[model samples]
Target: MRVRAESPGPSWADVGLAEPGHGWSGAVLAALLRRRGAAVLSHDTAAHLHGMPTPHAAAPSSLVHVTLPPGQRLRREGVAPHRRDLPAHHVGAVHGLRATTPERTWADLCTRGAPWTPEDLIAAGDHLLARPWSRRGRREPASTPEGLAAVVAALGGVPGIDAARRALAQVRVGSDSPLETRVRLDLIAAGLGEPILQFRLDAADPQCPEVDLYYADGAVALEYDGAHHLAREQQARDARRDRWLLARGVAPLRVTAEDHREACRRLVEVILGRRAAGHRIDPRPESTSQSGHDAPPAES
Candidate 1:
């Protein structure tokens, strides 16, 4: 691909399509690497390459983020350059192009400053720690909670390390999606005590269903229903699970992307015994069951 005017020639060629598809980013990174061998794709670009969720607001699709050594700099039209000393362990390869490791990319994002909030950082951390399933079997997590903590600890003097540390403290291992992380954070912020993540009703039974967020004291189970719940088959399965939970005296509350906040508010009232007389807080009228499937991993 002929990426730059001043470059010697094409660094890579495509034998298939005239227009590059998903590999366009790789081609751009390759060309940039040709110009400066030390530069590596980092920040949002690395996050995307590592198959982690990249917040759209924090990473505009138009710009490719790159990191150079302490004194190195590259001013390119479509590239955003960051200067930092990346250790050997922090760098990795994605599709043959150099890029920061998933953990490093996440830490860099936390320290990137404004537009990257604590909630965003927490969500990213949850994603990194989540062990998603695949056709082959359960896949290993990108990083453990300890791995993220070590990264934060090593980044002592970095600009946003404090925010990263705070987010790290809140990151849990079982949240399946960013929405679940967000709802958990929101509920905690609202002064509701932290709910146990991926709570299983029967701890000894491997076949027992797990709730996304559960309050053992009140027997309240909060399940965040994402777009996948719209499927007819999933709906039927959810209905069965809800029936089973209700039969067991568990209050199975469901929250969709749209009504989560309201659900949380109603839950607080019910938990605190503040609901008005004759008022009742019910699960989302649709399906009130946990999603048995894990959140699909991001595309690599």
Candidate 2:
């Protein structure tokens, strides 16, 4: 099926109907591949294929990005052509469609002249290095810090490589969501030292719960409660975990989706030995304290 009419010729042809779940973009990519034997998806297109998180500020575009050889070009109404000879190792198959590897896609994105902020780039890198847990179990990270470093080194002297390097320095493993990365960056910018990611209270206990971000010196744990935490079952589980931490003298700070900045502020206050006043900081009842005594609203 032709995707757009204003193209020089047919944008995409339906050779055989795309696989059941390939989606429209996948179908378009398949058609482009058939027409141009050496086209590979790159940039944002490849990032989506690899399951990277989209920046919240990014405006949706209908353009499909494809990279072709230096002398070859395929300009169409709904297509953005990048003419560069990608190394063989940088190209890979994602769900049957050829696309840039996660590392290459990241490098391409950093240098693509897009308006991605430093935090945006760091979040993307954290995603690439994150080993998140799912119903199936802990999933393997898409790429490693070393792998990303290699990509930057290979593309040295390329425009925007410096920005990529700067972001990479701040990228850490174990960030489950962009919000977590954002909060961590905010804390660092506020002059709070970097908190440990995925800190387990007991290393020997396989069942020990891990805190999203832990400041050992202050014994504070910051949990970024995303929308998923609003579920009744998850909330109960979180409550139990908070109680467990409280019993151990660790201050558990629950940060919901609505008030991350406030949460960070409370955390800094806790670290500086001052009680934060105003909006609720702890997930427990206002009257309860870590010591199981009736406590005032603010920590003392």
Steric collisions counted per model = 1, 1
Q: List the residue pairs that clash in candidate 2.
A: 1-14
TM-score of 2: 0.81
What candidate 1 gets wrong by more than 4 Å, as runs, is 1-24, 56-61, 261-263, 274-300
lDDT of 1 by residue, 41-98 (tens): 8887777666666562454345678899888879877778999999999898876779
Candidate 1, residue 95: how far the Cα is off, in Å: 3.1
Candidate 2 Cα lDDT to native: 0.72
Best by TM-score: 2
lDDT of each: 0.71, 0.72
After TM-score superposition, what is the CA distance of residue 88 in candidate 1 from its true location, in Å?
Answer: 0.3
Expressed as tens digits, the lDDT of each residue in 246-292 for candidate 2 is: 87777788776555546467656666562232222332232111121
Work out candidate 1's RMSD over C-alphas: 7.8
